[model samples]
Target: MRNVKLIIEYDGTKYNGWQRLGNTDNTIQAKLEGVLSKMTGENIEIIGSGRTDAGVHAYHQIANFKTHSMMSVYEMRDYCNQYLPQDIVVKEAVEVEERFHARYNATSKKYLYRIWTGRIPTVFHRKYTYYIPQRLNVEAMRKAASYLIGEHDFQAFSSVKSKKKSTVRKIYAIDIHKEDSELNILFHGNGFLHNMVRIIAGTLIEVGLGKMKAEEIPEILEGKIRAQAGITAPAQGLFLYEVHYGE
Candidate 1:
């Protein structure tokens, strides 16, 4: 068997999410597996680097699968792009070592959230960016994000319910950039809990809007109370920008 690594890009507007659900076939993993299984004449299941919530897009989602087919990686890429939905594309494919596992081998991930601060939202980017009418205090948001840029117990900032799984995650950096009416927040981290980045984004947004003070971040982190955090930002604004394998 040959281990094949794939770089995938998708618009998550219509899909349920990245993971395959037993009850539904409207998921990114299900779609890819169906195509690959058909292509390879084998029961092909892919391992994604991580899951993206519904309506959360991905620019460079990484995945890998084991196959017995003799097809070249280029051929596999073209074939997948041909059969996959227009919104989902396999940008690249390459053969890798048999031991390579997409999720386990991933070292870090980068996620980007886009906020539109203009009163009138752009027609093209309406589906991609979160629209906020009022101006945001970018400096305040940055100051608030500073508190999040280190190892911490992020139990308050996630929607994860499993008691056994650890909620501690290290955020390498939280970068906020403003260009005209668009504000981009990029998060680099070792890993994230369910809805962690979105919740963090929402809290920072509250700080930007003056609803929450920048000084309150430490308190929220210490409280470890989910209710103390801000709303979970909408999924459309979140994007799985990149996955790093340390190669």
Candidate 2:
């Protein structure tokens, strides 16, 4: 068997999410797998680096599959793009060592959240960004975000209810950039729990809007109560920016 790795990009507006659902074919993984199976004439199951929520977008999602087919990596990439929906594209594919598992071997993941602070939403970007008409205190948001860096149990900032899985994850950085009316928040982390980035974005937004103080972050982190955090930001505003496997 040959291990083939693929770099994928998708606009998740029409899909349920990245994971394949048994009841429906409306998912990124299902679409990719279906096309690959047909291209190679064998059952193909691709393991994604992460599961992005519905309406989230991805710029460079990584996935890999093991197959017995002798198709070239270039041909595999082209075949996938030719049959898959236009919103999803296979940017690159390469044969790799059999031990290279996409999800397990991933070193880090970066997520981006876009916020439009303009008085009126931009027509073309409306589907990709969250629009907030009022002004926000970016400095306050920055101050609050600093507290989130480093390893910590993020139970308060996620929607996941199960305590079985440890919520301890390391956030490498939280960089917020503002240009004109657009605010881009980039989060680099080892891994994230369900809805963690969205919740963090919402919490920072609240701090920016003066609804929450920057100093309250420590207490929230220690509280470990989901209700203590801000609302979960809309899925459309979030994007899986990149997956890092290290050089």
Candidate 3:
């Protein structure tokens, strides 16, 4: 048996997210599995690092699948790219350790949220960036993000539907890059809960807009309630930028 690891990139605008839902075939995982199963003549399953919400793009999403097929990794990559939809591409594929599991073995993940802070619409970036036609106080947003750069119980930033034993997670870094009207917020964390990053981004945006004070982040976190956090930023603005694993 061979454990094949795949690096995938996709424009998630029309898909229903990354996980495969029962009776719903519009998912990234289902799409890749269908092609791989056909190519290998065996039922195959791909374990993704995490489930990205609908309309959330990915720059380098990772997945691993085990199969008993004889096809070379290069051939599998080519075949998948040739057969998969134009919006989704298998950038790289290679064999990995037999015991490797994509989701469980992941070490860290980096997500990027793109925002357009301009009075006019960002014509070409509309699909990938959230448009807020107002000047954002970047420095204030930075102050709010500093509170999120360490281990904490992030229950308030998670979705109400998110049920986890412990909502505690560690954030290694929070980087904000501004180039003209484009603001890129990148977060490096051990793991994330449902709608966690989006909620964080929304909260920071509120601080930037003067609706929320940067000093209130700790209180919101301590509240441990969803209502205390800001809105869930639109999925289109969020991207699974990268996934890290132990070598």
Candidate 4:
């Protein structure tokens, strides 16, 4: 068997999420698997680096699959893209070692959250950003974000319904950047729990709007209670920027 690795990018607006559902084919994973399965004339199970939530986008998601087909790497990539939906694309595909597991071998992941703080409506890319008409203090948001760096038990930052075995994840850095009316928040971490980034974005928004003080972020982290954090930001605003492997 040959281990085939693929770099995928998708707009998750019309899909249920990245994972294949029990009774639904409306997922990025399922779509890719179905096409590959048909093309190779064998069952293909692709393992993704992470499961992106419903309506979230991805720029460079990684996945791997084992197959017996003799198709070349470039052929596989082009064939898959020819059949996959326009919103989803296979940017690269290559043969890899059999031991390379996409999820387990991942070293770090980066996520980006886009916020539109303009008073006027965003006409072109409204679906790609969170719209907030009011002014936000970027400095306050930056101060609140500093508390999120380093390793910590992020129970308060995750959803109560998340089924993770542990919530202790290391956040390497959290950065907030503003360009005109658009604000971008970047998070680099070892891993992220369900809804963790969204919750952090919500908490920072509160600080930016003066609803909460920047110094209160540590208290929220220490509380370790989901209710102590702010609301979960909308899924559309979040994007899986990249996943890193090895050193």
lDDT of 2 by residue, 1-247 (tens): 9999999999999899999999999999999999998998899899999899899999999999999998889989888888999999999999999999999999999999999999988998888999999999999999999999999999999988887999999999999999998999999999999999999999999999899999999999999999999989998899999999974
- Winner by lDDT between candidate 3 and candidate 2: 2
lDDT at 19, model 4: 99
Candidate-wise lDDT, in order: 0.96, 0.95, 0.94, 0.94
Over the stretch 1-247, how does candidate 4's per-residue lDDT look in tens digits?
A: 9999999999999999999999999999999999999989999999999999899999999999999999999999999999999999999998999999999999999999999998997887687899999999999999989998999989999985756588899999998899998999999999999999999999999889988898988888899999988889998999999999998
State how far residue 78 of model 1 sits from its true place (Å).
0.1
Q: Which parts of model 2 have CA positions greater than 4 angstroms off?
A: none
Rank by lDDT, descending?
1, 2, 3, 4
lDDT of 3 by residue, 1-247 (tens): 8999999999999999999999898999999999999999999999999999999999999999999999899999999999999999999999999999999999999999999988899679999999999889999999999998899999999985647478999999999999988999999999999999999999999999999999999999999989988999999999999999884
Model 4 superposed RMSD (Cα):
1.1
Question: What does the lDDT come to for candidate 1?
Answer: 0.96
Query: What are the candidates' C-alpha RMSDs?
Result: 0.8, 0.8, 1.1, 1.1
Error of 1 at 64 (Å): 0.3
TM-score of each: 0.99, 0.98, 0.98, 0.97
In candidate 1, where is summed lDDT lowest over 10 consecutive residues?
118-127
* Local lDDT at 47 for model 2: 100
Better model by TM-score: candidate 1 vs candidate 4:
1
Q: Which ten contiguous residues of candidate 3 have the minimum total lDDT?
A: 158-167
Candidate 1 lDDT tens digits, 1-247: 8999999999999999999999999999999999999999999999999999899999999999998899999999999999999999999999999999999999999999999998898988888999999989999999999999999999999998998999999999999999988999999999999999999999999999999999999999999999999989999999999999884
